[model samples]
Target: MLHATISGNVVTQSTTATNHSILAFLTSTIGQISPARIRVDNNTVINNSTSGSTRGILVDTPDTSTSPSFDATVTNNSVAIGDSINGVSGLVAQARKASETCTSLSGNTVTFPNGTPSGIQGLRARQADTAVYDLQTSVSCTGTAATVLSCLNPSATTEVLGTINTVSPGTCLLPVTP
Candidate 1:
């Protein structure tokens, strides 16, 4: 995905997921390297599991010599977990160079039925100003109400579900709107 929809100085890449369920999934990655100016909107990923290995979406660019990638957006995607998927990421981006920018990751949701396995993150970004990414709208649903939940004591009389998780805007980098 190398900026296929470029007109003059403007470039864009876009994808959407609507009314779909991904079951018994087996993939190391879903989306990768869609150039600068990309969008992923309104998709559902359900019941997906791997042998402790898999990534949902990767927004990245390898062109280290040019100006930074701009305006990458991921929005409104939902991921429902299966069992014991470790080190999985719902969204991740890499910007190694000083001039690189991350764009945005917004309005995405990840529901871990039994709670996310160890070392897994609902969303993450690396090597760029957190300002370039929008993690605020993303969420995680855990605990008893989740599709598959476990308890420390199976015979416990009452259960408490986990709370929803939201990313705070200022926690990333300098506060800047993308």
Candidate 2:
């Protein structure tokens, strides 16, 4: 009778409650609660529907509990989250993805630690994605390079150009075709 427990959809509507550990309070060494593995996958646990004082899901010890009291392994379970209306538990997904989104509007430039342009373009050129650049895609600088990259080809008309210092960006311009 060691580490005894129960598991299921537990709905606790108890308004006046104390010294109650709903669902589980399993422990080993010195009367502590430790479940070998609490796989709460694809299940929802909503506790204390009557008031906010109670806990929806608590993997914790009682007031008189000692060290190494309550140790649990919970997975894939959404607990304690609730709606604004009744203050009761709600939803499997916590927050909105639309609120976190910022780059929808134009002129918005999200830079990484080293000032990288966001989105697919940013992930494509992380330098660590060398294999993807080499094997998956290649941008050939035509009209100048007879070989792989143009800058190495002295006779190549096309080149990936760089500017000298004091050059105000637009000053280092190249010719365009009609």
Candidate 3:
């Protein structure tokens, strides 16, 4: 899709399935070019599964080429993750190609249950290519149940830039407070 706007929606999953509840992406086949501009705002995502890895919201461009560009804005979204064995992230924005990818995340909230196991990320921004990828964030939280830093993905290629309230510990630039 070239352009899309998704707002004010509620997505809930209460099963053991492992998948992304809300996903917006742009993919290309071979030499095809698929540039996308997407806006996701004011959405509520709740995951009540007790097993497997899952994502509440995912926005990504998986095509690894310079011909495809991606721009996304995710704001004012509420995400909740339940018990899981593997990595379960509340919100994720990724650019997996050597393209111009820009993602902005602001005013989002994520909640994890108490005693949440390891590999649970409240918010994550990743850039897996050597392109012009910029990820910005502001005012995001993981409630009072989990540590904000521990709930973030620490990758060498990933950088979370912007204003965020710190709550707990691990290794992150901006930590979110409840």
Query: Which pairs clash in model 3?
Result: none
- Put down candidate 1 lDDT per residue, 22-84, tens digits, no spaces: 211111122322224445556555545444444455555434333443444554555554545
All candidates: CA RMSD (Å): 13.2, 24.8, 9.3
Query: Which lDDT tens digits does candidate 2 get at residues 1-178?
Result: 2232234554434444432223433234543433232222233443334343343434322223222221122223333322122232121101011111000000111112222212212101011111111101113322321122222222212111121011121221121212
TM-score of each: 0.47, 0.30, 0.69
Candidate 1 lands at a TM-score of: 0.47
Off by over 4 Å in 3: 63-67, 84-87, 136-178
Checking candidate 1 for backbone clashes, the offending pairs are: 17-42, 17-43
Candidate 3 Cα deviation (angstroms), residue 162:
16
User: Ranking by lDDT, best first?
Assistant: 3, 1, 2
The 0-to-1 C-alpha lDDT of every candidate, in the order given, reads 0.39, 0.24, 0.61
Off by over 4 Å in 1: 1-35, 62-68, 83-85, 97-99, 128-178
**By lDDT, is 1 or 2 better?**
1
lDDT for model 1, please: 0.39
